[model samples]
Target: MSAMLEVVGLDTCYGRTQVLWDIGFSVAEGRTVALIGSNGAGKTTVLNTICGILRPRKGQVIFEGKPITDIPAHHLVGMGLVQVPEGRELFSRMTVMENLELAAYARRDGAVDKDIRGVLERFPVLGKRRLQISGTLSGGEQQMLAIARGLIARPRLLLLDEPSWGLAPMVIDAVFDTIKAIQAEGTTILLVEQNATQALAVADEAYVLEHGRIVLGGTAESVAMNDEVTRVYLGGFNPRGQ
Candidate 1:
């Protein structure tokens, strides 16, 4: 598959504090690419830079054969690059339905109503709680709402930052399953996750980031089987060896 988004030698910073250093990676069309790393390893910074929440001071961000390195965040959404941030940033005071409706702000066309219907259908729990304030929902439901909000924008390339951040094991499994369901519908995903095993399990390709640099990159299966990766990321279990 061809690359849908490419980050080449990216260098990003917040004021004088540099967070990302010469970062590079690509997400291929129709493929789920996983970026697994420890906390503060620049995983979220990569997504922020790509989405233009933070701009890169060096290198480029190429999307679907065009450069969008310094494009404004809103315009990037119009081009189908949507990001679901690390904290599941929802309008806490807004009702679930209202929060979802607000995601259409980036639409350049008239599919808002239809897209809203589609998102509600995909997440029936959100539909059931549509009238309730988003902040009142449980953690899993909040996560569902967050991803559903992103879907309402009809993104071609979805950037998810630490999607499994704070949830129960079962809830995390459900979230990953939802991600797989979304991917099956042809939306390419760039996923950053702290749950290395689960992230690598669902990924077509995986990259291990350390201190703001890619330490290892390969097919998911290969990376998972690596002795060091198994020790560090997979809790020291070589599943194949067991």
Candidate 2:
């Protein structure tokens, strides 16, 4: 399969303070790739650069082989690069239905209405709270709504930043399970997650970023088993204990 998304020597900055440094990765069509690292490791920065939230200083970001590093973030959604940012940043005052509708502003899917209903059907709890204030929903529901909002965009590559943050174990499981289901349905995923254990479980391939650069890259199994990962990333948890 051809690369659905590619980043080469990507570098970003916030008013002259450079953040990312020569970062690069590739996501094949319908594949799931995780950019795993702790805080300030340029994981989220990579997602921002890919989705056009932040323009790179010098590098190439190609989506379906078209350079899009200069595209506007709002317009990038139309290009099928949808990012579900951290914190499930939903319109708390808006109803769940409204949040989902807002996500489809750029797409003209023939079954848009049907698709909304399908989302509700698949997530019955969300359906039950369809008219409720999104901000009032439980943390898990809010996270689900965020993911559902992105799916409504009919994205080709879903860029998720720290999806499992501040979530309960059960909720994190739900999120990762949903991630796998999305991949099964042919949506390429670029995930930046802190939960290495779960992220490695769902990812086809994973990259480890540290101090604004990609230091280690490999398959999920390879990452989970690495000595560096075990010593620093795993936090000394025995597999049998888990």
lDDT per model, in order? 0.90, 0.87
**Whose lDDT is greatest here?**
1
- The worst-scoring run of ten residues by lDDT in candidate 1 lies at 233-242
Query: 140, model 2: CA deviation in Å?
Result: 0.6
* True lDDT of residue 191, candidate 2: 90
Count of backbone collisions in candidate 1? 0
Tens digits of per-residue lDDT for model 1, 59-161: 8999998999878999988889999999899999999989988898657678888888888898999989999999999989999999999988888999999
Candidate 2 to truth, TM? 0.95
Clash pairs for candidate 2: none
| TM-score, predicted candidate 1 vs. hidden true structure | 0.96
The window of 10 residues in a row where model 2 has the poorest summed lDDT is 233-242
Q: Model 2 over residues 1-242: C-alpha lDDT tens digits?
A: 77988899988998999989999889999788988898878787788888888889999899998999878988888878899998889999999999988877667767788889989997899999999999999888999999999999888889988888988999988888888889889898989988887777788889999999999998777777788886777785522222
